[model samples]
Target: MRLLHSKTLEFATFYGDATPPYTILSHTWGDEEVTFEDMRFIQKRKSLPEDLRRSPEFMLAFDAAARLLFPPNRDPEKLAGYEKIRKTAEIANRRGHRYFWIDTCCIDKSSSSELQEAINSMYSWYKKSAICIVYLEDVDISFPAGTWELAPGHLTRFAASLKSSRWITRGWTLQELIAPGRLTFYNKDWEPMISKYVAAAAISSATKIPPYVLATGQLHRASVAQKMSWAAKRETTRTEDMAYCLLGLFQVHMPMLYGEGQHAFLRLQHEILQNSDDNTIFAWEPLSSPMLPSIYRGLLARSPEAFSSTSKHQVERSYFTTEAKEGIRVDLEKAPLVLPSGEVYYVAILGSANGTKLSFGDIHHLKQFYMFLKQLDEPNNGRRKQYVRVMGIPNNAQHQVQHNILIFHAETICVRQQPIIPLNFETTEFSRFVLRPDTYSATGLPDIQAMTVWPLGLISEKKEIMIPSHSKDFTALVWLQEHFNSSVSNVQVLLKFTRFPRVGYWCDIITGKQWPKDRDSVDEWRKAIERNHSVKELAQRKRYRIGTRSEIRTVSIEPGIHADQICLFVNIDGLII
Candidate 1:
């Protein structure tokens, strides 16, 4: 059958014997008759939905109504274009009620009461449609002429039309961006594609302008609601027709929560009726407009084939057992955990493993390991002491430590690092000395052994000397100068602390008292502690070492006794300037 219709062809031949309940109505000119066909169809189709009332009586009433209280028909071509729309509506109705109630054909023209009732209930009808076909025939449905079947031949045309269409390219039409949340309308510049089609239809009908073409006007004379009303009066069927078309085109082109099937039509009607108003425009938004688009996009991105399948998140599973005294270690260097369903999770092992020992990286690995251990039904049980030995490191330094294990909370992650680098410098008497103690305590160090180095800024071994969290940006720099500077600008100082105390609960090695070896009182060291502000310039200090070979010799002023003092003083600028 030829797709295009000649201008204003009378439907008398189609209705000649097609009895009542089948009157043709143009949704654009509500209750208004098209030509004189209504007089013939009135008795036959008068009992149907009012939208079908293209009878002369309905038009007369509609016209009289407009003259009484409503405005004039400003959009005449949109009025004349009604017949062409009715023809297109015929094409979408072929599947019986498989596509019944195709609004354009079902509404009766002789009954204004039915028309009013239908218009008022329009939202529900559109929402419940079996197959809402959006005849973006106004925007050119992508396919060859007369081709509506799903075929390979239609694919190329579909792609090409989509690429060149102003709707998709400029993102300016209802069909192009119908996400869930907010309703959008295109501004004028991108109106060319659809407007040109309506314009051509208007010209063919020998009309000056269509109602929708008034959308071309720069002035915003009508509120969106008012314009909808105008559209409604022109033709209730076309109003709902286009709205259904827009909604259907949206479900097809953009993201929708449902998939294709027999239910596609039902879902379309539900969505359209739920969202549209009596004027056949969108209703007030039901969801948060901002989040609606995201939901829409998500629906679009979903793979339709997998809609009914179970999801497998990329997570790994493992099981292991360890002995009480000797630990059993399984290296996880980029290995996948195998599962019964053939699923796998990749894991990378950071290793330098030993029994009961945990390194800093090992400490982090323990948290995940603990979870795995619990999965295996094993507990810590307080029998094994965890130890960490630095065996092979990039720095080539070997050190060992017995970790004081504490139960870690499930939600808490690893501790944060401090600014100072831990100086494990080897001294002659004591092999390793931690110059900065703040770094140790931040990592939860219980205590430090051997050589004592007290940083002057620390109030005690218990507290750290760092800028407070709430201070303004530059406050740390200001505090740095107060303790170290006589001239503030160029002065430098050193502060140190021992993580391990020597004798009492809180005691450190002090000078200027009796030496443990010689028992001689060194008064010179006492004078240095009193001058706490003195900047140490290392270039001027006399450095002496004491101790035997292979027994690391440390720098010393003189051997002093360990004292029961809560804190110690060290002028670490190397030499007082």
Candidate 2:
């Protein structure tokens, strides 16, 4: 680490345990900031080259440094980067500290190893600092005389302005604000604005960072989501620095890759996952409105905006466990079925609804899950109670699946007005629905041929149901085809009769395809019944008028009934009888 002599303004490097107590400067970077090389030339009284002298940033630095060093005829106005550096040194000297560090001039960023070491150690450096001087360049310190004590109204306005300072929104300043033991804020004129102890509440409100963390520097007490929310609104000049700046907050380090773009954040999440098991890290929603068949669904959050509302919630790591053998596997389990064409399909089961619970609260939590449900094509209605099950195929096998499954508990939350306690349904099961290799197409719609639903357990009799692969109303079919589909396979299709909460359209038909042998018998029976006009007319009477509107007509057919006799029957004495 390099520290500047408070009185002499000469740079000196300190290593190991010999480093002296130093004050650090925390401020937003300006175009005219002094760099290590610039400081070296300034210290030797050497004239900068023509190009350097002509540069506005260099001129600004020269003027600010001249004002402090010569002071006798210095301009009162035109203060710039050097003024901040000078003010920091003067303040340190006044406090009897001989060494101080300014980011712009302290570390030589030209060296990659030095840059990486500085960043990885930045949080600790700030925490161990004797003091942190925060300069809010945009805040004005000129108030009416004697009102310096600050009337209640004036204080509120001052606090509000302080809260909105650009100093708090820079990516690098986040750690500087939280890591330092003692911090003092100053305005443009180098006048004291507020201290960490005095403005904790206002700072918390502005940054969404907890006051406790700011006060005690115990950031680990906050949840991962909460820590992420603090950076939700912060930004950096380089995209990757947004993640690099946060290394200290999470206390994890990795090689710095400047040009990696958004993958830097993904890497950060992977590193966090290795050291911590906080599932809430995955609990973020996209900032843009969610769409069904969403493109944003993934294991890592795209940005900090996803954790905007999670700052207030307390998350327990114990809520998640790796008890189930299937739980530990990162890959989705492929369905164990083969297409009639003798082709294999790859299935990837993303997430299931069986062990998960759902509830209604602030729209925030719904948005979080909705963000996770990016595979769906439509956004969930915020007003309704929603339950989502997410499933996906691995990228290698994604082309083999028609569409990923997004199973909602019901069509609308109002159908089950009473909140389902624990929200776990015995019949709910999630499985990957891989499409036949021959049938897979980029433009093809998802169908049941490529997907299958299985029962959660053997508590109840299960049956299988097949439908046309090109069906658009699969959500409705899954609900209405419950009984008929249940008798053939172990899968229980649980569908409830309810009005469409979003739109008033009603589902009328519960369609299913029987097994080959059973279908043949039904076809033969239908032909035998149609041979009689009386039986045919009775069967045609299944159509009914449901609503008051003349156009509202529905064809309601009860499954397992043919010619007014039960079509599906089992006799204890003789099964065929």
Candidate 3:
């Protein structure tokens, strides 16, 4: 470790227990800040080139050094880094500390190993310091402390300015704020502002960091998500440093990879998962972009912002288990079903809070289902009756037999309104609905509302049955098929039969002309529609030829039944025939 001599204005190296107590400067990096090279030149008594000495950063370092090294010859110019270092040394000297460390000049950043070591040890260094001097360059204060305190409405403005300081938003300063045992804030003119105790609440409200963690440095007491939320809005100059700066807060370390870009954060998440089994790490919601299908989205979160909501709640670690022996086990007798585009997914039975079972085949599908449930759960004039269940699956062979499964429950969404008929055939659960040939002209489209329906059920490895139903239910199912035409052919669709005011019958669209021949052949044809078919191909398929001779024209698929027939069926009372 490197420490700057408060009295001598010279740099000294210390290792292990030989290091003396030092005050550390915490401030945002400025473009003109001094560097280790500048300090070395100053220590060697070498004359800096005219241009170099004229630089704002070099001048600041020189002036600060002059103030401490020769007390009577301090410069009076208002410069960025000069006052911060000068006041910090003055405060440390008053407190009887002979050394202080400023990030810009203390360590040689040109050396990779030294830089890495410094970063990894920064938290401990700050924690063991005599005091952490926070320089809020953006905050302004009146010269006389008593007069400033006595000014009308100054305290409120001061608090607001302190809370909104650029010092708090820098990536490296996050650990500096949390890891220190004692900290004092100083305004631009080096006027004493407030202690960590006096400004705890305001800091907490501004940063979304808990007051307890700031006061006691008990970061381990907070869940991974809550800790991550502290750095959500914070930023670093280099993208990768966004993750590196957070190393101490998570108490996990990995080799620094500066050029890896955003993947650095992904690696951080990988390292975090290894040390802790908190599943809340996966509970982050994606920003802006449409949610990726579950299978395609990796375990890592894009940014700390994902945990913003989780941080607000008092998270309990007891909700997740680190021990494999305590994890919930899911068994899959078959390999994951493969889509035509080569993506693999599986179906898992999830138990709902109401004791009913629902099956979600893919993570993306589950997320979609949950989104609908959330909409239904939104509060209106009255409280909405809502139920939700989320269970985490350990990413291990023992907990996941053949496939990964995450189960959630919503009573208002998936509950069966009518008693299921006890049928003797195989049935599948589905949640998606689509409409095909999405456009139509009133003049050319048919008014044929009535249509024949064939309800096919997949039973065993070879047999299928055509279910017989009442004309009304059958017609309703056929009518429902038109509304689902836009859906991907491979998506299992749920069709609801309405009898005026009541939902009379509900069925799942199991298979059509392209249905797999058997269980063993399911994967060969279970390709996702968007993946297997191009936009042009889908568009071509949606068009219809109006006439043969001179009037041949392309039009959207006519409403009702076109050349492509519709098939639908429901399992009578969850029974398989």
Candidate 4:
């Protein structure tokens, strides 16, 4: 089987490198090679042709046709397991079960037009799927395992570049990164399998409507939280109704990536969608199987109201991890078990003290954290609770008031309220997000995506300058100069300056020129600074260096000069006098 190569496709596959074990299969059913387009058509059975419609014999033929597209390989555990499930599913289908859709087999690879059609509808298929099977064949865990492993250096690095790197796109969502690329194909699988592709298409299509508008529409149509509340109030028991209720959530609340139990939940949703109503919600309770955590079930049983929406409380409860992480100096011992759905939240069993000051910002942040925890709460008789609470801290009885410092127990703290957290950032750590030149510009002004790329620099002249990405920009420069020095903090940016190369060597922002020579030492950097700054002694005291750039030059800035005041000299002449 031959693989088609394109700049974006190749880049995606390359980045995917040993990061994950991706299967390379030809789109061939038996002897005929299937094109990607065919895979799309097959994947979107909802849009299948007359011939493609259901027939036990046709299904068998289609499955056989899919086999040829796969690359030859000894059965790896995941593939082998998938194949086993496929066979069983096919058997069920033959017996007149509605249908079983597996992306690898259902998608036709022979047609791009068809694939394009299906690609746009991926979200619906996921949201509506009976089950979404997430197969994690491999994991690239180059990062250290322990939370304390996150040191000052790590935090600095995070603070400096966390806002502007492709790292977020590295793990499960690489499909979104390097998007409009083949990795996007994997995106189809990222959705809830029980869903169809219609809503996804409408939201992502090139129509004049804004993307967020479409997203908002999807959110509106699938108001999972509203319905869940209704279901709870009505005391619905039909599994199908409950599943539909869950679908709204799977699409909106759950992380938009493949996860354990996500697929099973989708399947349960589909079954419930087909068979039950509010009264039958509990009928499928027995069928819940082991898709999501039992804790969710416990929560559902206790206070069905909790699963309504993803809010501050629910987020904390759902994503919170109890593992004490470094830099997070909260005493779990003083905290109580928080159930976000109900009012059961961690109160500072102790209040605040003036002498022992705690940042109100921390308290606010903790409030949001408590919100997440509230959502994770399930209704249970007072006998036992599914969650854990901290106990037995000696009350600072000596102090007038105790500070009830708080944090969320979920996955990562920063992601929960990025806008606020980015500003309150007093830590030695940085947050990074990477921005593509084309994507940055396409996003239009004040590119938040660009700002996420820390120690920011531009990929092109057209794109607006952002704080983290354009680290050389006056503001970014000052921030770097003042804060960029640390084991954790490092700045390496790629600039796509519009103009051509200059005669000498150095990264100059004014001319958009890149010099041929490299500045290797701190002394060399000092010389460069001396040329730029009149105060030679100041230049000596303030260290600078050549930071790496992609297509253009990246210069190191020292503390004191407000980044806003410092201008990138297109040529030496452009340097501010």
Candidate 5:
């Protein structure tokens, strides 16, 4: 552990029991933070050549150099991040603490091992703090000390002040909120408004954390799903910090992989599952994109955001076990919904089934947690069949319940952190992308033909692209085709752009002539998917060999693509089937 001298603000390294009792500072990071390097520079500058120290006038003339040399010629307090450190140390010193810790300057983050160690031990560090000082620079309340009126709506002012506080909405601040039972919240002016104990109920209302949990710091009081729900709305500047920040809450530790992105959350869930038998960890349900689909996802969730509504959901841990390679196997409650094709989908009941409205819906019957799952054979792990989450199907239809003889059956399926196929990335940057045909190819095929694609539902995606939606839902239906052996034998492709909260760009390429009775595969698909009524008729217009069976092509969303960049890459050689 690293600490500052509180009086001198000089950094000192401590190990295990050698670490002294210190106060920890928790606050949202600024645009430019005072780093460990900055603290080291201040220390080194103190031993500067006596001549340079005496020549304050020379240093002031070169203002930039003065900042590097020492805090002079400019108010270091007004700079981006120094005032918080100085104030934190001042508070700690006044409180009779010898040392203090602040994330920006205490830990040498440049070293990977040191950073990892600090993060893994961060929870314990905060939990052991004599007092955790939370500085909400955005929260300003001019009301004098001891002026809080503890009435029904009286705390409104305090809550309103915290309404815009960046501290509550940050990923790292969550652990800082939970770990230290004895902590104080200071406003922008460094005025102590309330201790965490005094504002537990208000903080709970603001953060969706139970008041008791905030006051007592007993994590066991909340279920896994509830703990996960707290983090769902919090945002982390670094993508990986979303998962890393919750390490203390779950009492689990793992290596910090910065570039791993959402996979970091999956790894966190895996570690939590490994340490504890909490099946509600899988109870997260995404309020999915409105783009109609037969798209499927893996058993694991994409991110903590998916678990936002999981607070009310938790049940007995049922047959939950994770594996290094083979994936996790859990017994799920499978809904009886036979699809058009032989493809079987199971609307597995997720935990919170207590008539509480969740992501599924608020209707009486829709209160239970239901998520779509599709079972498949795992060739690597024998001829055994396992289930992956089915994405995009409407919730009402996906998990249909009737007073019929067929009830939910108990079935076991394997789940892993990795998604099944056509990995979906959650991003809002991709408002829309033009769907155009890419050059087709097959290894050693005689020839490949170029495809010309213009949207049939809308104008050429080139001109009419970036329109929010073609219909009621945020979806755009595009008509395209693939040429196989000859011009006569072609496959008609329908490219449906996902809704506003778009996942990776995907197109359900259902290539087949015959399908089950939703009445005739091609026509029913046309009628089935043309929901919210974007277009009426998409007739084949001529005879062509479409294919033998139905198949959906879900594509992974790549980052940094523009609306003009074509994402439709179709290989016609496979259409020969």
Candidate 6:
């Protein structure tokens, strides 16, 4: 760590444990600001006898020579950034602190390793500082020093000034404001406005940070999502710095990838997931209006802007922590709910506040924080289950009052942090439909040999449906519509996906002449098929034949593209079989 002498701006280096206490500065950079290399205030003194060197005569001559060494234009006093350091140094000296750290001139950012370490250690650096000084360039507030309380008039002016202060909206200042145990705010003229302890409430109201959190650097009490929300509105000059600026608040470290753009936030979340199992980390939604497939994104959020509403509520750890977090997977507490349109949406409970039983009844209401999830597809080959968030702006982040919700308790769902777009996001059934034909040998089945499904190239590419492969009972619904001839002879076939008895699938027709609107309407038909054609477990090498045939027409199920998909083929003989 590098420190600047409080009286003289001479720089010095200190290592771990050996470093002395120092005051730190936090301020938004202006159009003209000093940088690390700009702190070039050199005073040269010739070697002299101790008595003579300490004498006023020798000091005057040394000062004159130093002035001649550098031109007036090169003076540090001319830089807009110099005054911040000078004032911070003066305050540090007044507070009996010999050393102070100002970000602009303290660290050598030119060195990559040094910059990385400094960024990762920034939060701790501010936390451990003897004093944290914040300079607000937009406001000029000067009040009585010993009396900490602001008058009613002063309070109004202070709130208005703090509300519009640019320091509150900058990315780096978030951690700087929260990491320090002792902090003071100064206005444009370098006059003290109010100490953090004295104005924590006002500051919290303006900045949306909890008063207690601002008073002390006890970050563990806040959830990862909440901390992230504090940074959601903060702006950083560099695109990646938005995520980089938060290293200290989360207390996790990873190599900085400056060019990654929004992906840096993704990496930050992954890092947070590794360090802590706070489920709120996944509790964010985008602010933009979503397009068809864009709405179906991965569990991980794209950026902190998605967490705009996260800090509004107190999301805490659920009692079901063990279930929510597996060995490495993040499992959300899930319950299935039926919409008015009868679409099944799984409510993935993110994290609950005090009212949950896990809270031991600290508060009255039992609130469950959740987001609506529509299962897109079951976990393919034991991978993460795929789901799409319920589109449209959510009416509420919490579940509706008890009586209105009908929650079917189901096991938790494990999803990946990166995106898991449904396998057939933008494509149609024909694109994903997999069919393996059944070849007959010398069995003398003349009817089967001449069968073929026609117009395969004419299949429309517009139909969409969700398929689940989570268990042995993998289900999918596929439709086959005959080409329109303006004739009643056109048949609409509903191929109900059944068990893959062996290599071949066994599907029963749910409805014959006309397709029913919903799957529930065919409940009795499914039951009838179960009784008449019970699924017989076949040997691995053998295949099962399914589907009833009329004299003129025939329909049967074939092996699909995947174990979870259903593919249909039709054969029309001379008769209606």
Candidate 5 has a TM-score of 0.70
User: Any runs in candidate 1 off by more than 4 Å, and if so which?
Assistant: 1-62, 74-84, 92-134, 138-154, 163-577
Which one wins by TM-score: 2 or 6? 6
TM-score for predicted model 3 compared with the true structure: 0.54
Residue-level lDDT tens digits of model 6 in 1-577 = 9999898777889989988989999999885566666565332232356787789987877656656855544545577887888899999999999999988778788889988988998998999999899999989767777654655566667878988989989999999999998998888988877878888888888877898898877888888778888888889998889988998888899888789998898788778877776777767877755422223445677777888888855645652332223122444565655433233566566543222222212222435556666665666666556555554422331223223343434344554433344423321122123323234323322232222221123223322223222222333333333322342222323333322332233343333433223434446545544554443542112222223323233444332223222233332222112
Per-residue alpha-carbon lDDT of model 5 for 1-577, expressed as tens digits? Answer: 8899888777888888888989999998986678777777667666567888679885555456656655554444445788888899899999999999999887888899999999999999999999999898887775555664344454677887786787878899899989996898887899887788988888888888889888899988687889989988899988999989899899998998888898898888878878877667767765655563344455567678888987766544545465645467765565545542223455566443322223322223643456666554444536335555656554444355332232455655675444332223332223444433233433333332223332333444252334342332233333334444554333334444443333334433333343234224455555555542444443212122345424333222232223212132322332221
In candidate 4, what are the lDDT values of residues 1-577, reduced to their tens digit?
Answer: 1111211121122221222222221111222333334433334543556765667787666656655754443222234333423442443344343333343433454555544434444444443333333322221112233442333343333223322333221221211211121111111122111111222332232222234323333333322233333333222233322332343333332222223323434454333334322211211121232221111121112233333232112211112222121111122212332221112334331122213334223554432222212122232463222232212111222121234333322122111100111111111111121122222123122211122211234223433233231122222111121122342222223222211121111222222222223425545543443344333221111222324322222232211111111112211111111
Stretches of candidate 2 exceeding 4 Å from the true structure: 46-79, 142-155, 291-296, 319-577
Indicate whether candidate 3 or candidate 6 has the larger TM-score: 6
**By the lDDT metric, which is better: model 3 or model 4?**
3
Q: Which stretches of candidate 6 lie over 4 Å from their true place?
A: 40-77, 145-152, 289-294, 319-328, 340-342, 351-366, 393-405, 417-577
Number of colliding residue pairs in each model: 49, 11, 16, 119, 2, 11
Ranking by TM-score: 5, 6, 2, 3, 4, 1
Count of backbone collisions in candidate 6? 11
**Each model's RMSD to truth, in Å?**
24.9, 18.9, 17.6, 23.5, 10.2, 13.9
So what's the TM-score on candidate 2? 0.55
Candidate 2's residue-wise lDDT over 1-577, tens digit each? 8899998888888987889999999999986677776676567644457788778988888777776654455332233777877899999998889999999988999899999999999998999999999888899855554554444564566668877788877999999999998998777888866678767777787888888888999976787888899898888999899899999999999999888998898788778877775656755655653222212133457677678877865554532322221112131222322223222222222323332333212222332222222111222354332222232213333334334332223121111111122211211111111111222223222112212332222112222232222232222122211112223211112221211221111222212333232224545533432342232122211322212323221222222211111111111110010
> lDDT of each model, Cα atoms only?
0.26, 0.54, 0.53, 0.27, 0.63, 0.61
lDDT of 2 at 29: 94
Position 206, candidate 5: lDDT: 88
Q: Estimate TM-scores for all models.
A: 0.22, 0.55, 0.54, 0.23, 0.70, 0.63
User: Which stretches in model 3 have alpha-carbon errors above 4 Å?
Assistant: 46-79, 142-155, 289-296, 313-577
Per-residue lDDT tens digits for candidate 3, residues 377-459, read 33346433221221121123222333333333322222111112122211111111113321333333322211222232312
Off by over 4 Å in 4: 1-91, 94-98, 108-120, 127-577
